[model samples]
Target: MTGVPASAAGGTGRTVPRGKLGTAAVNQASLWNIANILTMVRLVLVPAFVVLLLQDGGHDPVWRAWAWAAFAVAMITDVFDGHLARAYNLVTDFGKIADPIADKAIMAAGLICLSSLGDLPWWVTGVILFRELGITLMRFWVIRHGVIPASRGGKMKTLAQGTAVGMYVLVLTGPLATFRFWVMTVAVVLTVVTGLDYVRQAVVLRRRGLAAERADAAAKAGQRA
Candidate 1:
């Protein structure tokens, strides 16, 4: 793209085989993509997921079913959007911000609503939410230094949390109830542990950044002298 012809030929994706045209096409292309569209759709469903989950307090199986369906679909979108973006080279700055927000918003709505219905413990939901928010904030806090990449533990945490919350949303009875409880316990543990790990990394990164800045400053001072 850096040296592509200015107006050579038509192309399908982000580039069009031309310089200015390709840049313009890519810039315009950011506005619409399968991944971003899915993300936006997920965000739009948060209210529905919340309202339906709360409507019957999850006592009505039908309402719970609908809520669970919505939550599941939204969660699926969360997984797909990232994969789609990366696979298709459709990643955008907007995607980087919106994807995580959409993920947390859906999860938050589910956890809070489920807890409100007494299906989940308020304290448990609170802890998970706190961890998620803290790490997200830490991400922005240290982003100038570097990005904290995703980890396997983080993926497991999301899976467990989603499974537990989905089961609770469905108001599953009998042995499934116990299973949900255990999954949630695991999720809570991972959430806290991974969150602490992120905090520790952030501290290390901030220190490194400060050291680099100071070193550069001292180098400049020595040169001046």
Candidate 2:
């Protein structure tokens, strides 16, 4: 089997197995990789998106369209960055932490801006943001145990939210407005349900992690005796 050459292993004059080296390389993926760059682009777009969104009293269709463009770019990048990271083994600690923060930042900015403009009710924003913030905290809470891979339900929730928020960002009227309201409703429901599911997963993960630590400790003690 192919292996990492000695020169690539700190010039130690010893080759390393390909499997182990590949795993280590992935774990140490550079911060400057395409995945992390896309994530940073999303982060940069948030402020620009907000500026476009709130421009001209937040009612002009033209400016709203621009804001929606920015938002769309941000959301599109969100999908690609994660896919690229996982597919190409470009996942890094920075990507793991920043991707979610960028996701929440863009969405939170859009929601707060819409609420402030009286376009969306504050209660809806409150509900979605609360769930988002709670889930994020829960991720950090169990982070020491392991990373939580995004579930199918979580992907659905994100799609629902992006669609709903995108619609709201536009100057829809009459029937379209009503449709958006329903979409937002679904998004909100998904948000709550997925949040609860994540909480359950976090609890289970922490429990297992703790149990494993205890088992390791016992094994070490037995070995010593």
TM-score of each: 0.89, 0.83
Runs in model 2 lying further than 4 Å from the true structure? 1-29
In model 2, state the lDDT of residue 192: 90
Where is model 2 poorest over a 10-residue stretch in terms of lDDT? Answer: 22-31
What does candidate 1's lDDT look like per residue over 1-225, in tens digits? 354533444443343434666588788988699999999999998998888877744588898899899999999999999999999899988898899999999999988887877778899999999999989888999889898899998998899889888988886778988888888899899999989988998999999998998999999999999
Stretches of model 1 off by over 4 angstroms after superposition: 1-18
Backbone N/Cα/C clashes per model: 0, 0
lDDT of each: 0.87, 0.94
RMSD of each: 4.7, 4.6
For TM-score, the strongest prediction is 1
